[model samples]
Target: MFIVFEGPDGSGTSTQAKILAKNLEKKGLKVFTTAEPSKNILGKVLREALQKKYELSPKAFQLLFFADREQHVQNEVLPALARGEIVICERYNWSSIAFGVSEKVERKFLENLSSSFVEPDHTFFMNISAEKSLERVVLRGEKLEHFETSEKLKIVQEVMLNLAEQSAFTKRSTILNATDSIETIAQNIEMILTPMLFLQNIK
Candidate 1:
């Protein structure tokens, strides 16, 4: 199954993805963990752009994200799925829509760009307030990326919340309160997934 984690920067999606992957691996399941922009040349360029190394139009930036996603799915995600491993990714199609829309890009254009991508079997949206998100980023002591500001993240969170209710995501998405203790959130995810993984293993 393909599982994805989505949230604003500092919302703990990456941490949760890693924790879940590790827990699943310890249980003898074949698990593959990855994030976007992936570890590719295109991803490298995109990361630099995100860090403000150079500015690209919102459309151009989103396109780069799509390109990187295409390569990531074809060369990494697909093969792992074919091998029967559980694929857990941090950030996916939703990130593009949320971030792009927050940047004043057309939502329809973003959706069209993402139309050809593979949808995750399940998505976990780590919902957090903009204030809380900024607080966490400050605690991390890392420089903010392009979309890491309080105002931008507020809009991004709103966009993601709206996305969660859309037809494409409604049935397969779960929203978690990101302000909760990390262990509590992780336990909730493991509890929700354990039965499903058990059934998969038995098969």
Candidate 2:
């Protein structure tokens, strides 16, 4: 099964993804964890651009993201799933959609770009206020990315919520309150996946 976690920069999706993968591994489940923009060459370029090291128009950046995702799916995600492992990804298609729409890019174009990629069987949307998201990022003392500002985070969060509602038609999605304690949030995710894991084992 493919499981994805999505949210703003400081929404802790990365942390939760790691914790879930760790715990699932202790249970002896086969798990493969990854994130996007992936570790490939194009993903490296996108990461640099996010840090203001490169200037790209919104359309250009989204196109790079689309291209990176194609490589990611082919090179990493597919092989893990082929081995019957549970794939847990920190970010996926919705990240592109939310950030792209927030930057005023056309939604249909973004959707069409990702239409061929694999969709997650379950998506967890970590919902939090823009102020809270920015605060968390600042507390980490890391250099802020281009989209890490409070105003941009506000727009991105709203866009993600709207996307989450629309996503129900495609797959299972759960909205999580990211302000909760880390352990608590992980527990919530474990509860959701435990049953699914059981069903998979039986099948």
Candidate 3:
């Protein structure tokens, strides 16, 4: 099964992703974890651009993300899924839509473009307020990117919530509260997965 953990920065999706993968592995199942804007060539460029806060046209950055996703799907995601391994991805196709729309790109265009990519069977939208998210991000001590500001992230967070309501992911679309203790959040995710356990077609 393709499971995704998606949310605005500092929502702890990354941490939850690893926790889930680790716990799943402990169950003796095959598991693979990866994130978008991967560490590949195209991903590297995108990462550096964001980290450096380089001025970039939204279209150009979106194009780079597309390249990274295309190659990532072909080179990594598909092959793993073909093996019947559980794949835990740290972002979703909707992430691009959220980020792009927040950056002034037309939502329809971004949505249609992302629709061509594979979607996750289950997505956990890490729920948190913009102020809380920003506080967490600052606590992490990482250099802030241009869009890391509370104002922009608020827009991004709203877009995620809107998409979730539209069934952009899981019909029951779980919203994991990110402000809780790490273990508590992980437990919530585990509860969400318990019902779907038998449905997992993992090898």
Question: 57-149 in candidate 2: lDDT tens per residue?
Answer: 999989999999999999999999999999999889989988998789998998888788988889999999999999999999999998898
Taken over the whole model, the C-alpha lDDT of each candidate is 0.89, 0.91, 0.85
List model 3 lDDT by residue over 165-201, tens digit each.
Answer: 7874347477777888999999998888866877654
Model 3 ranges with Cα > 4 A deviation: 168-172, 201-203
- For each of the candidates, give the backbone clash count: 0, 0, 0
Q: What range of 10 consecutive residues in model 2 has the weakest lDDT sum?
A: 194-203
TM-score pick, better of 2 and 3: 2
Per-residue lDDT of model 1, residues 39-105, tens digit only:
9999999999999998899889999999999999999999999999999999999999999998899
Considering lDDT, where higher is better, how would the candidates rank from best to worst? 2, 1, 3
Model 1 C-alpha lDDT versus the unseen true structure: 0.89
What are the candidates' C-alpha RMSDs? 1.6, 1.4, 1.7
